[model samples]
Target: MKLQVTGSISELLTGISHLSEELNFTIGSDGYPISVVKRPGPIEVKNANGQGEICFEKKIHFYRALGLWLQNFEKSKEFHIVEHPQFETSGVMIDASRNAVLTTDGIQMLLRKMAVMGLNLAMLYTEDTYEVPEYPYFGYMRGRYSEIEIKICDDYAEELGIEMIPCIQTLAHLKEALKWNYSNEFRDTESILLAGEPKTYEFLRTIIKSATKPYRSNRIHIGMDEAHELGLGKYLELNGYHNRFEIMNQHLKQVIHITEDLDLKPMIWSDMYFRLASKVGNYYDKDATIPEEIIKMIPNVQMVYWDYYHTEESHYEKMLTMHKLLVDEPIFAGGLWTWNGIAPNYGKAFRTTEAALKANKKFGIKEVFATMWGDNGAETPIQTVLPGMQLYAEYTYHQEVGPEHLAERFEFCTGYHLEDFLLLNHFDETPGVMKDNLYESNPSKFLLWQDILIGLYDKNIEGFPIAQHYEKLIQPLHDAKGKNHDMNLLFHFYEELARVLSVKAELGINLKNAYDQADKDAVHACSEKLSSLRKDVEKLRLAHKKLWFSTNKPFGWEVLDIRYGGLLTRIHSAEERVQEWLDDPTVRIEELEAERLFYNGIYTFGEEGTLGRNLYHRIVSNSVFSD
Candidate 1:
């Protein structure tokens, strides 16, 4: 496979060599020199025995050509061609502020993967993760990135031809930062900045100056979305009642002025403008319109319409059309669906992103990006969402790339098959049930975290043969866990979680039935099962701890420890209660003997029906014996 690559296609060959080391290659020679000839449109590759000429109009097209070459070569098929990116700026945005800050090494690995995928942009969506020299407690106790760290990442991204931009909150989503004593003067309710305050603009100046210092790109994402109750907070107390939009517009202009003074172009989330202009709080309202006066009030900042939910192309078509009417050159931000729980929802991400990208292309949109948010605790590992990231890259360059080809390219880039990695998605899906609900309603997460004494989601597993599903996932995941030792630990955790769920789901019903009939033998059997499930729970906990520290920092593991530790204590209490009931017939196991337990479909954070908290609440709510 000896070949000579030209200057334009040299980087492409280097990328191929990084993926597959077996092929021997060279550059800038007479024998089969890979030439980059100018083509009118679309990337075309002419190859013979891995020796070829890549014909591309732009340098960016070389990556797509390289991807096509790798796909054909790996499959032992003929060479193929690809087209230009549908969106000019195609990339992924990582949520670094939501508890789990991605380590620098983890980020570098992703950058390498992104390079092979032909992605051109990356944004670290930081709320308070970056250092603010003036604010001491901005990212306090949260693993925020230092100036040196940011500079290193920027330099690395530049080497990979990726423009790493700073995406920080300017108006809202500053909840973490507002917790500090110093932030009291600047905060408008709890999350928004105080509008019409000179001190607020001073704080914004410090944030903008500190955040934009390390990044090479002059473009900054000034997040102004979801500031619903803008002026109603402290701003109202300071200044007489003014329209919320007016307050928002005034604040935005101030922020833009700061950015302009710093010689930076500002981009913002378009939801606030629409929310205020249409006088509708809903972000996806189709008939929402912005008044020309309000539109004129908006400064020269790039408007980013971040839509992550719509699975239909028509929804995106309408939204994108409306966004274009509101602002020029609107960038669409779709979700990769990694923030759900302990796993990435690849199924939903694929369906929705494909539709969104198609709509973006149809509208002739020039820029788009995918977001991997870590909403609650950032439980899911960033690596788990690689398949989703690869899909976004493929869709950007060539919309018609099928599953098989995408899988091959993914394996070449990441050393893991797409099917093997997609096992993460199965943790959330029920066997026979359609997962039409949002990521919050993931059954596997609920099953894993459900209480052993009172299984709320256990009864919901009617059609889902989850025990068999976990049994089937173990071997393939084990086989795929070759050199990726951390992945093996992760798989072991899920395997132990499945074992616990398999027994826990049935233990409650059996115990209840046995107590009703006063069957000593059945009670003893249930006791034995309880003992086994407790052991499985311990194993799962240890595996989870190991997996967590292996891939992430030790900052966020306390949350897991608290949740799992609570489960173990509840299990022990259940065991003691059941034993006391068995020893003395007079002991009232009334709650256990009560009518059949039913699955209540509830989804709210810190609520009774929520997945993780529900099980704990159930145990406390229906305790037959003292703890």
Candidate 2:
């Protein structure tokens, strides 16, 4: 396909031209023609004679118009489609601070997808994963992006007509950056900065300047949320328990002054303000009240209200209403649900997006974006969140769209099947799982990483056929690799995940049951199965490692490597313990006698019952691990 461009839309041709190679389309005189036009209205596409005319209101709208045109290109003889975008600034915020920092190439790849989806905003959530010229240990051993890398990504986003804003932290969420010995002077606690300290403002200024230098956007997201230890650490020792609200407000004024000096607009997470107002310090407190003086003293910075877990529209509506009390118009940030576990939770993501975006529309909020946060090691492949992104894109333009329309648009934007991308969810959404999966249940992750000997989640899954569920998904995921072509790496990882879970899911249950029954033969079989499972674990680790390296920087893979090695060592331990028990019946297996309990403490093991956990440390043991 060939694109004829004019005015501002011409820059996007370079950004989207690569699609010619990826989508296997030839750009020639005889190829399909798309005339790009820019104006100030809804995205309008019309086909007449032999060429397609794509008229868009914004630069971001052009890419979306092109996608819509392509979706109906050859199928229809002649047609017209008009899509009106709801939000002014809508896109994604990739969590680069988590273990996985996307490579520059991967960021460019995603920009294309964002352009296709008609999203105009892009943010890289880098707490410490961006280079600070003066601080060498800011992102030590973390694959932090250099100035050149950030510049390249921002340039690519510009070509795609997307606003790439630098999302950095000026207050808390800097545990990785602050743990080094050099940070002792300014650090109040592990994660929070010493807000009252004189040097803290200087440090904040340096980081804020460094973070914004590579981007063209005048906007910066200054993360000031979840700073629970604001005055509880060294600040308490120095100031003798100062009021947290006063401390926070003073810190905000200092940070805002820096941003103002740099000629930039700043946005802060609204959680801290709401938390201080709440009776119990909850961000979503419905009855939370702010003192009249405090309300009058609120700064002019943008208040970003982020909600990811809500499955109900009423909760978003209620939260949005509360946010307005803080700021006249608040920017809404929803979650893409990629942070859950090894696989993306499409069910939870779709439910939350629909519910939240609808609330955003009803409230007349103009700005929105979904966050792809990588909590707990960031194991899930980022590309698996495509269908969820598509869902957000559809909701951005239409009040409502049918399943068939979403699927068709998805296939057009991404040359892959929606069902195949969705099949990745089967790892966790197995037989015992609920229809909506509202509880954030992630059995696949806990099952694979849990101590098989102790069997933490074994009792919860004793009666359910979870292993059989994984077995059923093995072949489909394995076969999907060839169908997806470029996505073979992701599917191969998924296939290996299914392979590992098929055996590992019920290994502890079978072994413990056999030990209780005094069935020496069944116990022996379980031991042999552990040996084979070790090989499968190794395969899964290699598959995941390969996939990670292909998309992300090599720095983060070490964290996951440690996790894989731990599971392998525990499996070997299980084998040795089982062998010792088989040889000497007199020496009893202490762990096998231990009783299993429900994962959520007291929930029944049936409908709507779920672990709702995604943290690996919690799944593996009750002891203290990573904090």
Candidate 3:
């Protein structure tokens, strides 16, 4: 693995060496001479005099070449390097606003991984996760990054040849910030900014200025998506009647002016414009059309068509084609599926990202990136999605990359087998079910957190055989416990979670049946199981705490504590109710016998507003014993 390099390639080798110690290289003229050549497309590598000579057109291409060499050497495969990047910018976006602000060390670890995978852009998707000098309550108590920390991150990324871009919400998704008294003057609704207010423009300018000040890249992402109720709230109360498009157009003009003044290029989610223009309220409607007048009103801001749901290549093809009709150059932001629950959905992410990348290549879309959103308290760690990230890198350069090649590259880059890492997705997959699409709705999460007395997901999971699935995962998880220390705790956490879910999933149904039969023996058995399950849940809590603190900041662990602690308290109450019911057969368990329960065809649990609905989507009501 010794090699001699010159010019930009030598610089690339130095950077790669800093990231990975597994790579061996020596500055000698004998073994391998890696050269840089100004080629039009794809890198060229030739073997001469028993030495490997690699040539590339750009520094990023050289990094990809080095990645190929490392993969070949590690896997004991032949050296074959021919890659050209599909997009000019390909990277990962870490959502910092969703309560899991990555520590500086975490950022460095990810940057190192990104460098090894030949990703050239990195975006910290900050909604309110950076220090704004004038706004004290902005990102307050949220572990936001300071200016010094941002500089360190930027410098480190620059050394690795990554363009660290700033992605901040300029319009909507500012619910956390809007909670402050100062933000009351600018709030139009719960989440969006006031469109035509003078104070709103001032707030936008300050936010844009503060966000762009830390990063070196002039490219900024002003997230303007999902502002559905844009001008219908307070703006409606004040301004009588006005066109929604007019409101958004004026708002965009004001925001773009601030970006221009700051010498920054701003990008926005194109969904809002599409949703507002189309007759149907769908963002991904294939035949959705935007009014030409409305399209003309938009400024020179880049449109980012963020699509993470569709799995078909034709869906992306139509979407990208529609996006191209709107703007000359549009960026495509795909999802890595890290926000699903406590684990990464690698299976769904892989298929969706592969299809999206192929569509991007076909449509000649230049810039592309995968978003790792931390929705719902950012429970899932970003490291769990390393396989998906590596896949993005693989598909960016090589169009025909197969799963085997991806797995090998993943091992070479991250020091873990792809199969071992993909076990994270197995917990979500229902056994013997072909198309068990969770659609970002994780059953394991709901089952683990569902009330034991109510058993919302209990009868719902009739044929899942979740207990057997969890039993099978225990040994494999124990085997992978030593692969990555940070991830070891995660594996152990899932194992504990599976153990708890196995019992919790069936406890409610079994307990209710025993109660209806008025069998003392069955009641006693259910009581014993409940007590043991409580102990197991307590152990899972401890493991969850350890796993949370191991890779994430301490700020967001409170959410886990709340959920787990709440479940623990409910279990104690469930035990009391069971004892009461057994002692005197007259005690009423209203939750177990609610009359107005409606079972949607899909969910055996109740519908959206029902007591047995999904835990992640709806808040668990206050305890029945509280009154």
Candidate 4:
């Protein structure tokens, strides 16, 4: 399906070359009468008999129009597509701070896909994952992108018609940034910097200067969200008790002054304002109200209303109205569900993106981007969220998107089936999991990481054939891997993960049940299963290790190494205990004898009868994980 073009698309040739594997057809640039023309309106692709032109106003839209041109023409179908973009700016922000920073080449690979998907911006969310010149400990050994690495990525993105903006935390969420002994003097608590300290402002100025120097865009995301302990720590010791709102505003004013000095336009997370307005400090409290005086004092920075948990359009509309109360039109930041646990939760991502984007369209949000955060050590591969990315990219140009259309568009642009990428969602959407409870319940994570002897979530998931669920998922992921050779490494990780979870999901339940009944034969069988489970876990770890190194930096791999090592050691100890119990009935199996309580730790949504949990610390044990 090679198409010859009449006009030169030399500017996009570099990016297209980078994305050669995903392209189904070759372009000669001189033979096909299909030309590119700059128009003043919506992007249009008119293809009839493999000869037509792509009309687009913006440079990025040209690439997007080309995607439209190929979507139908490559499949031997005529296409006359017109796209009116709903948002002025549509893109994605990658969370690179949580131990899984993508290599420079990987960022380029993603940028190429973004160009074809009609996405125009990318934010590298690096809390402490980028370098600061003066401070050696600043992002030291955390796989922080050097200034050169960022410059290279920026150049690559620029060639692809994508704006790579610098997004960093100016205040709070800096626990990793200030974890070392060198940063102790400026810490308000563990993560929050002192609000008014001269040294704190100095640190902020240096880090802010370091963060934005590599990017061409003047737009920056200055994160000031989730600073729950704003003035309760050393800030109180330095300057007596003050209202949290006053402290926040004063700190914000100082930070804004720095951005203004740098000639940068900034946006801060709108959650802190909403959280402070509520009595219970909930960001989504419908009854929350902010005082008019405080709104006036807010500096002239764009408010980013990032809502990812809602399923209804009305919820987004309410929050958007609240943001408009502060500014005329706030930039909406929705999420693609890559942050949950071991797998991406597409059930939640699709539902929430559809609802949130609809609200954004109604509210006339000019700019919108989807956030793909890597929470909880970033266990899930970022590649698993391609379908979620397509969901956001599709909503940018069309008011209504059909399922078949999205699937076809994704397959054409990515060379991977939407249904196969979607099959990865079943890794988390097992039995006892309902659509109403998708984000909170990461059965794929907790069940895999849950202790064998302790049985933390075993009782809640009891009587459901959850083990059979993972067993059924293996071959489909295998088939998907065969079809998606480009991302087969990612598919292999999930396939092995399903293999491990299939056996380990109910291992503790079986062992504990037998121990309670004093069934010695069943206990012996559990010991043999433990030996095989260790091998399965090792296989899963190796599979994940291969995927991580191929896609990410080597620094964060150590954290997961510790997690896998802990699980293996714990399983080995469980085997020894079972053998000891089998050797002598007098020596009781104390761990299995304890009556399992209905447990839902406070780390996650502690709903009644819900087995949802995330975070490695909570999954590993009931005791304190680290000091």
The C-alpha RMSD in Å for every predicted model, in order, reads 4.2, 2.0, 3.3, 1.6
lDDT of 2 at 62: 80
lDDT of 3 at 220: 92
| Runs in model 1 lying further than 4 Å from the true structure | 1-4, 9-41, 55-60, 77-80, 277-280, 435-440, 462-464, 482-490, 589-627
TM-scores for all predictions? 0.88, 0.96, 0.92, 0.97
Which consecutive 10 residues in model 4 have the weakest lDDT in total?
601-610
Ranking by TM-score: 4, 2, 3, 1
State the lDDT of candidate 3 residue by residue for 239-316, as single tens digits.
977888888889999999888888889899999888886788789977778888888888998999998888889999
Give the top-scoring candidate (TM-score).
4
Off by over 4 Å in 2: 2-9, 29-33, 601-608, 612-614, 624-627
lDDT assessment of candidate 3: 0.77
Model 2 per-residue lDDT at 96: 97
Model 1, residue 95: distance off in Å is: 0.7
Model 1: per-residue Cα lDDT over 397-454, one tens digit each: 7767688978877776666678877777776664643463343446556666666555
Worst lDDT window (10 residues) for model 3? 604-613
Of 1 and 4, the candidate ahead on TM-score is 4
Off by over 4 Å in 4: 8-10, 604-609
In terms of lDDT, model 2 sits at 0.86
Question: 542, model 1: CA deviation in Å?
Answer: 3.3
